[model samples]
Target: MKEKWESYPSSIRLLAIAAIIFSTGMACIWPLVTIYIHDYLGKPLTVAGFLLLLNQGAFLIGSVAGGMLFDRWGKMRTIILSSAGIIAMSTSLGFTDDFTLYTIFFLLNGLFYGTLSPVINALAVVLWPEGGRKGLNMIYVAQNAGVAAGSALGGVLASVSFAWTFFGNAITQVIVLVLFAVMLPRYVKSLALKPQSPEMPAQEAGKAEMLLSQPAPAKKVVWGALLMLCAGLLISWIVYVQWTTVLSAYMQSLGISLRQYSFLWTINGGLILFGQPLIAWVISRFARTLKAQMLLGSYVFVLSMLILSQTTSYTGFVAAMFVMTLGEMLVWPAVPAVAAEYTPEGQEGFIQGLVSGTGSAGRMLGPLLGAFIFQTFQAEGLLYIMAGLALLSVLFFALHSSFQKGSHRVPVQTAEKL
Candidate 1:
């Protein structure tokens, strides 16, 4: 197994590494951008909140569209085009001052950025067709590591200048684009000789082609899972998004400085980086059942939020985040793997889009939800809401499992009847 991984083409490996670096830069800018809007640009908190929500909304649309495009046009082309779009968007962001213009530009950015998640996952699967669960975990580790680095660096850089942060992200995108262009040809060629699946008959092939050429179906198990996941994800994100919103206010209430605010995010990212890979390894060894993992993880996640509600000190807050990260490490990777398993063959891109779109929905709702709760009843209310949602998710997941088992047993029972 090790030899097989070691023998993966240099070009593919390079692309994966470049993808990680590019994502790192992208992730780093998010917290900084919010800070810039609120602190540097003199925008109202509500406006900043709207901008954040808009970005995720655009991403949701883009994720679904990008998935369809990837299925039709192929993963390499989709990635290249999306990267070019991101480069333009990120660079232009540094130059804009108008809140409206920035909002529009970020919307565009989200549109293109949405393509990255599904394309990267699909590519990883293609690269390690035999690796299955193990391959997915590796991809998750790579993704989270990039995110961890980006969030940590972005927080520190925001303290410097938001423009510098944007510029830094643009530079990474350019590097990734150039590397992809140079190496993609060899990567494609290396994979081309893998035996193709048996072709359909000419008439059937035409029909299959026509079906793919049309818009994707709305109904799919992946879509169902996406919706189910979104309910839980939104609750968690509502809490997490506070780090960009009222958490600063909460810290101020506690006599903490802006530097301390940045440090909190940096700490969050650091813990995620250190914890995710280890969690992945542990999950691979012990939690062979994704359903069980998600159930237990969700329970732990809710407990962390409940802990957050009672935290009066920075240390206590950080400890809550640490517990949350443990749950996240188990849940995040398992989500994609479970979604992929539920997806029908030939619809990888579509299923992945659903996954991304669901996540986007959570992100879109997170800030607003956080803001609303904080305004209405303060930080403690936010945790109560999250805990309630998490409990609801546990119920939903249980029902989903029962449904799945019933569906599977029906055919066996019918066979016995026959």
Candidate 2:
């Protein structure tokens, strides 16, 4: 196992570690935010909700800016600066007693986290180009693991004191900051000067062949595909986030306990971690191309929502969650991986940022949209609408993939590569 672990590239290993640490800290804070503001700080629930929305808005802006910086300001410098801000903001939150100061610190933390996310993803692509989607997938898995760990840890700490939870978030970030400062610069240097081996899979080689054989894609064609990808991600998240936002209330109305709803996420996190190898096999065998993976995932999402619309039993909800988790496993990472493929020479970071920012847009919109629908039409109407939006997302992905059909005039093997 040790030898197997070392066989992977150093950059991949380090990035995975950083993702787990950063996400764990993030999980610690986010799940407790509304509770802290309402119960401890004496704010209304609506104010807390609004603050969360603003925090997400800040993150959306930071994602775009971070991507541009990654392209122009240099990856190492951008990463270090973002990490510093994250550490400082989180640490400030630990000591903050005033609601206004806490809100400002919270927004800054979101901004820094948003900045950090895309940079890490872009770095995964650049540092391990040969690894293809595997690098991105690894980071995704690490993040889910962090969420599981941090949520459990945060809950325990919050039971003791909210201050401890804040401190815990800062402590994890401090470790991440130290790791970035000490180890990441070497990889950044290597990125500039190193000429590494091409350890890509045969499928990736074929994809490379297809790209090389074609004339440089017209800017319009490239943008068409990229914008479609962004649109797909945005719609997909808008529907997907319903599980977190509105579904909990829907389930409770049917008499499902809060613990049971929480357990659904526990199942999600568990499957994402332990079900990776099986999921990878399914992807390799059935969905060889990124397009296929995404479409299949989108269809699965539709199925989940359809089932959810009728599901009143806890067992039924559990089944739907299981299916939903499988779908997201395919869809989420593939978005960034696909975006990486269409990236221009110097705009890799920005493309990734664009993707992340678009997803943030979806997250920001999802709850409000779902709530409006639910208020007017109730649970069944909202679920069906979510399903329809998911299908629309599938359309965007299919249209995006269509633009690349010209480039994919290669042999079957080449077409199979993503």
Candidate 3:
């Protein structure tokens, strides 16, 4: 274990840290961008909504592309190129004034951002073949920490000047880009010489070698479950994404300042930092039956959204966000972890990419759904739609659990063969 942890090259470590910083800056823009478009760009909320959707759509494309590239070109190169792309896109956005042009840049930004998951995961596994889960979780903590910081900072910067927020993000991206370019090569080279751990049996090693020798077949069951999980996750995220998108407008409509709005994100981040470890520990204790935890978390998420919809004051809103984030802390990490578990050996990159791509698709759909509902009926209507979706997700998950239970059987014959 000591050797496994120590095997990670300093370059990979530096790159991971840089990635976290870049992600933090990227996240900072989410909550503020809606207001920036409405007040500064003179665009309609629907147009802003479309721009947000476009960003995630671009990310979906990028993720698919990134996964394929990672499999072929290697992980370090992908990270370097992606980070550079983000830097260029973000910097260009600062200079552009046209709403259409800004939307285009945002799409490019999403594409670059999409490269992160596969590359990061691949690097983690390569660096610590025996400690994939622990390493990945650590990386996740870093990533989420950056996100929380970015969300909070974006709100504060938006209050001072929206331009400053964009510019600051651009600068942070550039620094990370430079840092990654210098550091990644060194890390990759250093880690390349480490021997594969003894934990991998010769047969499993042969299987991996065989996989690398030929193209992978797409598994139907895996794909089907992925689709279903994506649908459920999309509805769940729409509820959360609202906090950064429509919810900001809704809160402002109720007379909340941007500063107060930003602070809520800080609270959300703090809660995640504190709550995620506990949630992870709890999940570990019941790792054999994650479906139940998933269902419970989804139900809690629904209740929290319902509570959020009823809030008339800032305090009430904050309280509701707390409850909602608690559910989120429980659900978010589990989704990816479960995806990783179900992924076939030697197809980690493809499966992780699919998971991220599906997530991007959900993100694209969430805001559009939220904005349309908000526009048609009211914010209350938006919450109702989310609540209904969440409840439906709960039902689907429950049915899925039952189906798995009924189908599950001890494969005595297969066990004997093994």
Best by lDDT: 2
- Highest-scoring model, TM-score: 2
Stretches of candidate 3 exceeding 4 Å from the true structure: 1-16, 35-45, 98-100, 129-133, 151-167, 174-218, 252-260, 280-292, 309-313, 374-384, 395-418
Residue 202 in candidate 2, Cα distance off native in Å: 25
**lDDT (Cα, tens digit) per residue for candidate 1, span 295-381:** 777787788878878887878777777777777776666666666655544456766776677778877776677778889988788
**lDDT, candidate 3, 174-228, per-residue tens:** 7776775676566556555444456899999898667556643345556666666
Error of 1 at 317 (Å): 1.3
lDDT of every model, 2 decimals: 0.68, 0.85, 0.69
Candidate 2 Cα outliers beyond 4 Å, as residue runs: 1-7, 196-217, 405-418
**Of the pair 1 and 3, which is ahead by TM-score?**
1
Q: Ranking by TM-score, best first? A: 2, 1, 3
Off by over 4 Å in 1: 1-12, 151-162, 182-192, 196-226, 276-286, 402-418
lDDT of 1 at 30: 76
Ordering by lDDT: 2, 3, 1
lDDT of 1: 0.68
Error of 1 at 375 (Å): 3.3
lDDT (10s digit) by residue, model 2, range 228-267: 8889889889988999888888888889999989999999
